[model samples]
Target: MFDGVHLGHQSIISKLNAISKGKDLESAILTFWPHPRKVFSPSDDLKLLNTIEEKKYLLEKNDLQHLFLKEFDEDFRNLTGEEFVKQVLVNKLKVQHLIIGYDHTFGKNKSGDFSLLKKLGPECGFEVEQVEAVNYKDLNISSTQIRNALSSGEIISANEMLGYNYSITGKVVHGKKIGRTIGYPTANIEVDAIKLLPKKGAYIVDVFVNNTPYKGMLSIGTNPTVEGKLITTEVYILDFNDDIYGEEISVNFRDFLHEEIKFESLEKLIDQLDLDKKRTDEYLF
Candidate 1:
C-alpha cells in the first residue's frame, strides 16, 4: 500500500493489537497489491520497498491472521468514501472496530479521514479508533521520510524509522563470472523488477538462502574495474560455499560502509576486496 511497512505503519498496527487486549479478536490487514500507483499509472520512480509477497510474510510476524489482497482498479477507485466503508468494512468483514492512523484515508478523492469516520461510525455500528501520529525525537515518522533517507543513503536513520534493518529480496541471476575470475565468487542478484534497492556501495548483509541465514557482504553497483556495465547485486557469503544457483535470497542490509568506486586496475580492485572481506567479517562476527 505504502512504499514500505516502515515504523509508522508498525505503530498503527501495534495500537490495533493493544485495543484488542485478550478478546482473541481476529485481526486483518486490507492492502492493495501491485500498488495503486502502478495500476493507475506506472512510473519508474514508484519503487516498492517490500513486494506484496514480502509484505504478507512480514505481516505474519504481527498479530494479523490474514491480509485481504485487493486489486486496485478504476472501478474500486470510483467508490465514494462512505460506499467503501459500507462495502468493505461493514457489509463484508462486519468489522466491529476499525483502527487507522490520524491522517489515513481511503475511497475516491480520499474523502475519508478520521473526521469523516467519526461522523459515520454511529450509523455503521463500528467504533473508529485513530492512533496518534508516531514521533521520533520530536520529528514525525513517515514513509516518505524513510524513502527520502534511503534515496540519500541515510540508512541508520531510515532503519530506525523502520524499526528494523533495511532489507531487499530478489532472485539470483547469472552474471559475467568476472568476480569468479578474480577469485571472489559472487552470487549476482537481480534488483530492478519491483523492489527498492539501496545505495550503490558495500554493505554488511545477512542473506537468507533456502531458509537458512548466512552472513554475507554485498556490492551494489556496476563493476567498472571488471568491465561490467549493468548494475548488479553481488554477494560474497562469509565462510560459506554452496551452489546457490537460481535460489531466491532475502538480504537484510545492516550498514552502508562505502560507495562503489572504480579502481584503475583489477589488481587494485582485488586488493580493496581483501579489506572489504575483512571489514565484513568484523561486521557479522
Candidate 2:
C-alpha cells in the first residue's frame, strides 16, 4: 500500500510471510488513497506505476489479504504514529507485529521513525520489523529507477527490475482518427489521473484490451513528430482488428524500439514504421 510498491517493498511482504508462517494468521497491508503527496502537492509531473485499482490487483498477486485502504485526509494525517499504532493497529485490529521498510517514517511530519518505534513498541503491545533494501547490482532497487528508465525510454532495463513489462492504465476515448489513413488505427485512451507516462516516443508493448493481451506498439507523446498537441497514449494492436472506443484498457510497454522520429513526408513516416514493426517482432517475441 505504498507508492510505486517497488521490488524493495517486497522485503516487507517477505517479512510478513516469514512471521505469519505456521501462525495461521492472515497477512494484511494498509495504504492510503489519492496519495498523501498528491493531495498535499498536485503537479503535472506526477507519474504512477499503477492506479489504485491496479495497485489492488498487484497486492493480491502476492497473496496479500486485508488491505486497509485508508483515505488521505486531515484527520488521518493529524494522528501521531504512536497514536495510530496504539488506537488503530493494536487496539482496533489487535495486530501483534508491524513490518516496515528500512527507511520507514510515519506520524505527522514523519516524526515516528524506527527509533521512535523501538521506544514505543512495548507500550503499544506490538513488535516492529524492518526490511533492508534490495539491490540490483550496485543500485538499490527503487521505484525512482523504474520511472527514470521509462521516462528515458529504457523499457528493457525497466522491465528487468519490475519482473514484468511497464504499463499505464487509462480509459479509451475519441481521437483525431488520423491514423486510419496511415493504415494503423489506434485506440486513444484519455487519462484522468496523474499516472506516470513513458518518454515521448514509439515502443513495442503488449496492450491489455480487456482480459486478452495483444502484441502492439504504443505512442506516448504530444504528437510532436506529427505536429499535433494534446499528450496522448495511442496503441495499435497487431494481427487483430476490433473497435474499442470508450473502453478501459491498459498498455504495457515491453521494449523500447526507437525514438519518435519526424519525417519530411508521410511516406517517410510510414517507411520508418515498417522497420519498427519488423524490429518490434524480433525484440519482443
Candidate 3:
C-alpha cells in the first residue's frame, strides 16, 4: 500500500519516474486493495491512511502515469514469488524497469525481496532498482512511523514525515446542539469508518468550506463532559457562522493542542473551551 505516500514513498516514486524517463519506459505504481491484512487478519481492525479514492487523488498529483490497483485475495496471495513475477509483473504489466523500496517484499509469505527481483530481472528481461529510505531529522520516515505519530496525537511530527498536512474529509451531519449552548457552535463530521483517525484530542486545523480555508479547532472523542457515549468528530470554525449540514468539507490537522478531558461541570467545560479557543487563535492567527 502507498498508504500515506509519505516522504519515503515519495522517494521511491521519484526514483521510479527518473529511471522510467531515462529508460523511456512508462511509469506506473502497482498496489493491492482490501489491504493484505484485511484479507488475512480481519480481526485486526486495521485502519487505513487513505481510502481508495483518496489514494487515487494523491497519486494523480504525482508524476507517474498509471496506477494499478490489484485485488488481493486468497488466490492472489497464494502465488509464489516466481509465479507472481512471471504472471503479474512480466505478462500483465509488461514491466521493463521496476523500482521498489529498500524494504519492499511481495509474493507468498513475502518471499520476494531485492535479491529475488535481481535474480528474476535477468531471466525475465527487466531491470530493478531499490530506493534508499527517506529520513527527516535522522528519523526514518515510513507509513508505520507516521501512523504511530498520528496515534500519539503528534500531528506536527506526522506532517513532517508526510511532507504535507494530514487531512480528514467528511460530510457535515447534524449533531446534538450541545456546543451551541456553550457558545461554541460546531459542525459534526461523518467520515468513512475505515479511515484511520488520529488519537482522540483537540487539534488546530484548517477547515475547508466551499473550497475556502478557515481557521478552526477540532475535537475527536466522545463528549465525556456531556455524558455522551459515541465518539464524534466536530469542528468549530472561527468566524464562520453558517449552516453547513450535508456539506462536504475537509479538515487539515495542524498541531495537536490538547487531549480530551472531562470537565466537572458545564462551567468548567466552557472555561476549557475558552482556553482552547484562545490557544487556537494564538497558534493559527
Q: Which candidate is the best by lDDT?
A: 3
The predicted structure with the larger lDDT, 1 or 2, is 1
- Give lDDT for model 2: 0.78
RMSD to native for every prediction?
1.9, 1.9, 1.1
The superposed Cα distance between candidate 1 and the true structure at residue 212, in angstroms, equals: 3.1
Tell me the TM-score of each prediction against the true structure: 0.92, 0.92, 0.97
Q: Residue by residue across 1-285, what tens digits does model 3's lDDT show?
A: 999888898888888888888888899999989889998998989888888888888887998899999999999999988899999999999999888887889889888889999999999999998888888788788888898899999999999999999999999999998999889999999999989899998999999999999999999999999899999999999999989999999999999989999999999989888988888888843
lDDT (CA) per prediction:
0.80, 0.78, 0.91
TM-score, cand. 1: 0.92
Q: Largest TM-score belongs to which candidate?
A: 3
lDDT tens digits, residue span 141-200, model 1: 887777777777777888898888878867888888888888889999876477777778
Stretches off by above 4 angstroms in model 2 are 43-45
Least lDDT summed over 10 consecutive residues: which range in candidate 1? 16-25
Model 3 residue 59 CA deviation in Å? 1.0
Off by over 4 Å in 3: none
